[model samples]
Target: MFARLIRPLGLCLILALPALVFRLSGIESDPLILLAVFGTGVVSASFVLAWAAEAAQVDISGGLAIAILAVIAVLPEYAVDLYFAFTAGSRPEYVAYAAANMTGSNRLLLGLGWSLVVLIALAVAKRRTGKSIRALTLDSGHRVELGFLAIASVIAFAIPVSAQIHVALGVGLLAFFGFYLWKVSRGDTEEPDLVGPAATIGALPRRQRRVLVVSLFIGSALVILACAEPFADALIETGAQLGIDEFLLVQWLAPLASEAPEFIIAILFALRGNGAAAIGMLISAKVNQWTLLVGSLPVAYLLGGGGVALHLDGRQVEEFLLTATQTLLGIAALLALRFPRWAAWTLLGLFAVQFVFPGQEARYVLSGVYAALALGAFVYHRRHLLPTLAAPFQDHPDEQAAKAAEQESRTAP
Candidate 1:
């Protein structure tokens, strides 16, 4: 077991080495070099985080671990984005950077990350079974996530329509997030069937396993905190030097780096034929990003001496509209608790269209298309709407089982 652990563990450390040296050395480096060093470090640490999260289910409560691990992506991205928001209080120009990072990460999680999980899971299923499964069914218990995500998605449209992120709005979003954690905690615990490095770590004795998990979580978070700022700055500077739009770079590249862990971890689960867990994790991530991450931006700005609201310009407003609409479409797609191939392709295709037509007009057009499609989807799954709304507050199957067992035991003569 010790020998088996060496390769995966060593690779993560090695990948992180250059960034650690660069960060500690304090020697000024080229923007491109900094991007590579810090980017690699983030990716490497993300892998470690992935392993720790998978192994965490053994130590943490079952459904609760998913909720906690979903925030794994939030740590670095929030650090980078909040830096921009906090700075925007004084600089003001940094407000656009904050918006770009938030919008980009949200869109990327649903577009690329969610689609890839489904597509790859289908491909793996074809090889294993000699037939492709077109739709991946989610566990019924996951309605808790879908339910909260749906509420968040509906609430998200207010931001673009208002062209502002107010403290009240942020608090509202945070309320939903709080309820999400509450629902997850109320669910009964179950042991996850883990594999790969996570399995190796899970095999450890209880105390040792816990110590290792805590160590990895702390170590990776520190590495991420140290690297996120440098990585973001490097990407922006590199974009300027290369004559690329810094908005595009910050929107896409920064998120690509910070979102790496969640994406990689989801892909791993998908490859293992656990498509439900894979996509479910991404959905949880989207929920947290939409709620916790988005909600925190204005609060951070205010703390940095900005006013009570984070205002968005016209372009940023359009971007938020596009992101919110896309989120609504995503919720509609999963209203039936099944992700189909056509929906996967539709999301990926529309997301790719953004790069081809990068203009304010295109954003409005895409938002319209997304909104229409989402409307259709909701209509088709209309029956599930009320149940989805109530799902978070309802008892989970495991919880019901536990309750019934306890009741019967107490009534025994």
Candidate 2:
């Protein structure tokens, strides 16, 4: 009883902390104070969101559950970036900041976030399995995510070439995301392997469990929506007050706050030896950002009355190209449904190159490098590519059928 109450009580306190701070200080207080208060709230909300997602696995297929979790986890990033895009309509100067925030968040997830999860998984695997683990092997069912991500990557490369995002592009991306959700929803359900607060909630009787899930979802969503704007605005204001580059602050600091909770949740999953789910959640997140988040930007701009299209200046163009290429490289690395240690390090090293050489030439060079690596990987895994692409449209199969297919692929000459 005590152990059960501990996690629930702690989660409730975390969820209340930000609201308490906000009520006491108000949004009109110091920028730094607002940042601290709202930021803390977003983090607490993330914990509840994560546990809720884990518990939801009992009601949904693992794939669909992670996909839904990915959507929720990225809500903060969407909140911050969308705010920038929408505000950019009235203040054209904010256009670049919007692009900066989007590109920075995407790169950060693949670079730092993905790499950290992989490393943590490797460490945990070594301890539990009594053998070194070089890579994280994903279930074949994840082909649905990888395939859709690949398609989205191909479409994203066109954004830089076009120099603007049109409403048509937004529709296309949203359509793709909708199709993905529909496909995943039909997946076979499995018994949820729960932990922490999620396990506590999952153990309840049906009615009680559902009530807790609904309560958690509503509570966390409300907290995030309430705090996200203030937290984002405070970051920009604090940057100006401190003489920091506002664009850099929006690009990095804002994402750090919005993304920190998801990162911690993934790390927790990794530490528990559930590396596949951890990586899968992040991969699903990448797809969401690449599609829905990117798609919604132009819509937000238009809703703000910016123009018929959202234009990308030279810097923003470079950022988009770099982000798209990085995504391509990441998808290619996971072509075989495996994320290797060397690949993780390579991603981090390339990401680190930006800070070391912050020049236009470096940006172009990195983009070319990523594109080349991606091409090489796609070519090497050409044999497996077609099947992966077909996975989403293929009929759902039972475990035995999936295993048979896996065996056939391996045994083929």
Candidate 3:
């Protein structure tokens, strides 16, 4: 009893640290900053609790994590963009900035995060003998769904940047939502089960689920908003003082800090041997950012003013292109279906190359390269794609088999 109580208390403390840091970061204490700090503490603790509850159930779903992380991709935009949109009399610029960030974040996740996972799997190949590297098979449902997403992603990219993104984004989001519902309703039986004692574990109680969901929603909102103010402000002030580009500080450093939750959560899931969920959460985050987050910003800006515009100079354009290209590579790498050591190296290579590249044309070229790689990989794995897509649906039976097999293995030994 004491142990259980102590664990939760410790986690609460851990989550609150960010908010505390935010409060202490600046000498000038804005009242809103104070409010954000308090709110963040509450929200972070709630998300931790929700995560714990899900882990306790031994569930490996990625939907919740994806949704939560996606919120962060937009949080920074909303926090700063909204302020400028309302006050600067340049609502269009605010919308443009928000859209750019969302799009950029999505590409980064796909290009960097996905590629890293593939490469990491190879480096850690011998770490676990029980898990299979070729475990990701898409079922027909998933295939159809992913096909839609692929098309949507492509179409979205093709649309001239100046055009309204609302319709495209709305359609893409609806498709994803529909796909998610179908996946969930099919039950989480799409993979081989983990070896464990089934009788001792029980289904999650509704009350606990409610507590977790509510807490996470409220806590995340408050925590992120609170952290954003200080993080963004610090980046601007410190960068200026240090003779660094203020935009660089806010754009890059701030996001890395804000993305800490997703990073921590993904690592936790990976450690638990739920690679699919871990990877899926990151993917979902990209999808939401690319579609919903980017889409909503323009609408918000328009409401704030009659027109929205974000002046993209050459440097900003280059960064945006680099982001998109990276994402294309990551997505394609995942579709490869085999986790080779080289895959990981390539992912890191692509990410590193883009990291240093300084022009939009260069990024655009790399993105094309990424697309070509994906196409080739898909063709190479054509025979296995069906089985891979169907694997999630078949995981239920495999899970039961693994459980039964484990029991027998233990008995025999």
Candidate 1 residue lDDT tens string, 1-413: 66888898899899998888898988688888889899999888877887887888887875666677767646878888988899888878889999999999999999999999999999899999999788888877777788888888888889988999998999888887887887787776666868789899999999989999899989988888888778888888888888999999999988888788778778888999989888988888888998999889999999999999999999899999999999989988887678989999999999999999999899999999999999998887676666777777777433443344355456647
Name the TM-score of candidate 2.
Answer: 0.89
Model 3 Cα shift for residue 24 (angstroms):
12
Residue-wise C-alpha lDDT for candidate 2, range 232-324, written one tens digit per residue? 788788888889877778888778877886787789889999989888878888889988998899889889879867888998999999999
After superposing candidate 3 on the true structure, give the runs of residues whose Cα lies further than 4 Å from its correct spot.
Answer: 1-100, 123-125, 130-145, 159-213, 306-317, 336-340, 378-413
| lDDT for position 79 in model 3 | 61
- With candidate 2 superimposed using the best TM-score fit, by how many Å does residue 384's alpha carbon deviate from the native? 1.8
The best candidate by lDDT is 1
In order of TM-score, best first, we have 1, 2, 3
- Better-scoring candidate (TM-score), 2 or 3: 2
TM-score result, candidate 3: 0.66
Better of 1 and 2 by TM-score: 1
